[model samples]
Target: MEHRVVYLDCYDGITAPLLLGALFDIGLDLNALKKAMAALSLPAHTITSQKQDAPVSGRSARLALDAPEKAVPWRLADTPALLPPGTLKELVRQPVLSMVKHIAQTTSKLQKLPIEDVSLPDITTLLWLIALTLGLDMLNVDENYVSPLPMATGSRQGPHGWEPLLLPEALEMLIRVEAVWYSTPDNKQVSLEGAAFLSELASFEPVNFSVTQVGYGCVPGKSASDGGQSLRLCLGNLSPSSRRAPQPAPSPVQTTLEQAESETDWVTVLETNIDNMSGELLGGLLDHLLELGALDVSYTPMQMKKNRPATLIRVIAPPELGEQLAMSLLRETTTLGVRFQHMQRLKARREPRTIQTSFGPMLVKVKYLGEQLISASPEYEECARVARERNIPLADVYEVARSEVQTLIIGSRKKT
Candidate 1:
């Protein structure tokens, strides 16, 4: 099916008003948005926007919730009354509450108060949450992929003192969502409203789509800081892409394995070169790194600096665990520095299954490309142990396990 897709380039960070403004610029129905907002029946609010073509060109939104009503502290019970009953509610009701609960839960911990007793500071916050959410779903996009976030490292003088560009609230939410981010020298600050709202709506994955329209969401800045920081949104029709499973080997009693399914997400690669590390010491780290949440680790022999033979240690891990793994590497390996970068990884979906073989039950990894099963490989460690216990060759133990799974697959296919 052809799907509408939006690519959000959060190079500078995002804001709820900026988000909705971009969606509005990209053809979100203004009347429909007004109608959806009206269903809430809260105090009156006005949504306005204007085109800006000065230091920047885009649409900026102004959301004015009524004074007294908008200041009401948010409660969990207020969720049901936040949205009217309809498709929009069905799509976004839980996400809106989930976003609120995340804040409330964090607020509870920070304040040393009970969770039920915590409430968002004001209803304006909740209104913006629902509005930003509705803005996205109301577009009816099938998928939205967010670009890697930029950690604005530069700071400036604040009224209090020197302050970091990204605030504590925004940083906390970024961690909660496990955002894929990279350090930037740029001084753009991300807001909690932006990060929290986008977390529940989009993914950081690869997409192949031809953009139909591009909209910039920014308000013309009264000063330099606010002027150029804008969220770039590209709307497009998604090109269907599928990971096809390789056809399995044919047999007389053919076991049509299920196709392989695949998933894509960001992973961090930690690499460093070492010239004076012992092979024995480096080899011992394979298991050590695995225990430290490394997805995979390996070493490659390479020539570094004229004639020095070095081993390049590479570690692939979840971005969230990258720092921990890097720390472990520095402490354990004879390396001075570790370089890390986040990259999107596409891998076949696989699950563990136990099959009764001649040597009893053995574990195997059942891999799928989608609905089709491509291959079922016996677990190496388990097969090796079973071979030793049964006093049989390892290859023979593997064959027995493979045959067992094949028989099961064939029988199941026949029944179906």
Candidate 2:
């Protein structure tokens, strides 16, 4: 059965409690939530959820720090002599690493520090790891699909006093929000894109939504006065798609995965190495390729002449688009030539999905045909935000999401 998951947008960003609140709002069993948490490190903290009126009407869950200042203290933990070859390999499971890195970078903006001096977890890598562990489908994050929030000019006090209001990016990085839009402190209006994303996720009409449970994660931010950062987690469930929505039946059709795999298709793999191009520029080019029908594009870190750091970029696409996309690469970056490969592909298909987790809602993209789900990835935005707030493993959040999504789908089928 096909399914579409709706997500609750945190306009101001997300908090551990807020995630719990959102799940409660949509209807999640508290007993199931406690059972899930009990499997993790315990005697560490307390999670309490209660009805609140301030943020409209919903239940709010708060994580009372057992040891207020207790965090995974970096200074106290083992320091890497050289970042250990695959030490970062663990980051694939830790979203906090990514959040911490993001916080460190954004803090550099607020405090005027160097990027190299900043240190933290690799949140992006961690989200990917967790999603992989849970067997949830992943999506190609279109950073180019940037929707900007309205800017508010003025001064406001943060942890410090009388400072200019931090822009959306700064706050988003600070609080670890997935998708955010700026607005006056007083609720008046919202960004068009932000509003649209929310409306689309919540409407649940032709696409009815059924929630399972919710969880919470904490956001960890480093203040000069404070030693380390924190995060919270939250989870929820939603309906996929309705097979019996009562629509007119179309003409009979038969599609076979085996036949699709047998079709002739030539693909070109483009590769290039340039030391001058910024990661941002390279990323943009990759985005265009995917949008232009390129099958896949990625970068691998490598060393250039004189042992200088560099990246080996690879792009795969149909042979017909080779020339046009090559031109795009040349025009967009400083690379002079792109290496190519001509090869035949078996089959290709991409499906986007949303799952209710103990933390919140996530959209996972899967690739497969027939009855098999070949690959899975959890929605990065959903996993990253909850991981930051809950101070739990991003992998665990992904695990819960993967488990719940399967449960919901299977449960729905049995009911019908």
Candidate 3:
């Protein structure tokens, strides 16, 4: 089955108002947001989000502040209080708290100040944080992917006059997550509140996923020339792939228990996101990666930038094959770059055992934790063939095979 994913293109950078606008633009319910945010007990306020195309493309999200920055600015530690206790839905509570902690810690580490000194975002941003968190849950969002930071250039009019392009807190978040950022004379700075929350929720996505729709987040008060002024959200589904037939040539790296366990220290992960390839093309690419000696190759559906459906291809292999596999990705896919990471890996000792079953003979992979039994799984191909020949339910073959394997293993252990 395929699942939904949203990709936020933060080329222009984000602020609380900007995030609100984007959410509103991307089909976030304006009225629902107002009702949800009203719980803050903030001074009288009304939010207006219109799907306007000018000033910025897509739709515009406007937080009309009926009150000034309010006396006694709320600090990061006080964020929990800003939204009344028990006001948040249980599903979003932990994630929202996690966002708050990420923001505070990011601010503290970068500014050389205590977390308590880090101030809470203004009313608009605060409200948007809650809305976005709740929205992610409501959308049943399985994952979020964020682009690299775009360096802020020059200065912007701030409450205290001209200030650095991107807010300090936002910059801290960019640095902490090690987000790859680019700066040009034409870059736009991100907002303090926008940066922290967006950074926290993002997980890496590989290339070549599928996108189904798009929503735009238009920043108010900024034009295209301002740089990084708008946000584009690409929505898509990631399909779970069917299992592959066994490969015989080089066999497989994990053919034996020892090789699988010993690979712990040498495994490297290679990934890339691709949007321009078709399903037929991907099959060829998968075979190519495996021929390069990949222990496993998998594809996940993902939304790529610029309203494109893409695939995130992941390859697991020993370190020795890293260079070759990476070369294969670049040579075969539309991706401009590839990402590599070393991973700690372990596998239970498993071996094929021939077991008697009502259908006839069956092959099962018996696994162990040291000397103790773990599980015995009937091979898919074997079970599938049994189902086909006898015209029985596939489930029946699986259940009967599992039961016999268990009985046989237990009897042998007792005799020992």
Candidate 4:
């Protein structure tokens, strides 16, 4: 089936209203969206799309929501209480509900808060309704539909300060929606979570396509330059491929089992020697590096020349991040210089799986060699969190997560 490609150019920052307005402008049916909201038992809110003029993007869309009755704030746990009994099951189908659950899970992890403590803004619930109405879960497309850059506006406070403006659940929902494409130029400043979401969509290669339709969504806020705030949603279609004459197949290359088993990729290893830095400073720097997406960061005590004891900071990261990591080492530590080397690494295919545990849901990293499962371990950070929240030993949380994942895997095998 030919699927329409949708690109969200958030020239301004994105909000739930902006997103829904853009989708609406791009041909989403209002009645369907309203119907889904009714099924969810949410308070009545009116969504209207209107054309407005902007200095930068010219004609754009404006979306307004009216829900005066729902003035009280609600958390994720409050969702069930807000809706009628069995309303979710009766109104939302499995696919849409699954998408909603996934978004909630991602938001919970991102915020480092218990699922019950995490607040669901009104805009977020509305976005879910739009996703359900548009059948976002059923779209046929690869992850490449989203852009690489994080979503941001050119404001003076910088991207880090703008984090509060984003709704984590809404952001996750947008990324996983199959057919819809989210894009921005390379020069834009995207939020950290927005950039992370975009990275998941980076596996898709660019295709040549033409714009078939365009829509604009505008926010009521003012831009830094006193211009109007808006975003463009472009609908594109790939041109038909021309028939070509068939050619002879190329011969396959033969390789030994040892060679196949020894498949390797290059990674950058950054090292810096610090003798004068305090342990507290070094520890803080290490945490910061890990937060910035370092694959691994470790330190080893070593004796330097003249009997001075020093710490060797080692960072393992993708080759693309070598330069940035090196700069960080210089800026954040007392290191005058940073040395890096490209080393070959052999790794098994690894994927993350989530399992429900007594404490909560924990993410498990599972590794596979061909079709055979090799190693499965719960993510240490998540397990540690569960332990802290549940007032249990960390080891206990790990065991429960591991056992749950194993049971799930076994059950799936039996079904197959």
By TM-score, the best candidate is 3
lDDT minimum window of 10 residues, candidate 4: 238-247
Give the Cα-based TM-score of candidate 1 against the true structure: 0.56
Question: Which has the higher TM-score value, candidate number 1 or candidate number 3?
Answer: 3
Candidate 3 has an lDDT of 0.70
Query: What digit string (tens of lDDT, one per residue) describes model 2 on residues 1-416?
Result: 21324333443333334444444445555555545444433235555666554324455545443664544423201223323324332322222233334444555666676755643332222222222221111221100112233334566565546754444434545243344356544322222222222221122223223433332222222321231111121222222222224456443432355544433455778888878878888788888889988889988999997888888888888766876776677657776455554455655576787766666667876665544455566776777778889898888887887777666656655775
Best by lDDT: 1
- Could you give candidate 3's per-residue lDDT for residues 1-416 as a string of tens digits? 45567777776666666666666665677777677777766666777877666555777666656766563565768766655547776446545665677777876876789888887546555555677787676667656777776786788788879878777777776665677677866656577667767666665344334777777777555575753367777877754331122346654554555433432344679888888889999999999889879999999999865778888999998876876787777668866456665555666667898888888889999887556566788899999999999999999988998888888778767875
In model 2, state the lDDT of residue 410: 62
The regions of model 1 sitting more than 4 angstroms off are 68-70, 81-88, 154-163, 226-228, 242-416
Off by over 4 Å in 3: 40-43, 69-71, 110-112, 155-163, 220-222, 226-228, 242-365, 368-416
| Alpha-carbon lDDT, every model | 0.74, 0.47, 0.70, 0.56
| Candidate 1 per-residue C-alpha lDDT over 298-393 given as tens digits, one digit per residue, 9 for 90 to 100 | 889999977999999999998778868877876687664565655657666789988777777788888766655656878899989988887989
User: In model 3, how large is the Cα lDDT of residue 77?
Assistant: 85
Q: Could you give candidate 4's per-residue lDDT for residues 1-416 as a string of tens digits?
A: 23346565655644344455566666676666556555655555554555555533333332334664554554545544554435543223322333344545677878787776666444445344434334332232211243332443233443456442344544554455332334443223333223333333222333445577776666543553454466565667532231112336533422432333534566779888999999999999999998877899999999997899999999999877876887788668866456565565766778888877676677888876555565677899998888898798998878888888777767665775
lDDT of 2: 0.47
**TM-score of model 3 (CA atoms):** 0.57
How do all the candidates rank in terms of lDDT, highest first? 1, 3, 4, 2
Worst 10 residues of 2 by lDDT: 135-144
Task: Compare candidates 1 and 3 on lDDT and give the better one.
Answer: 1
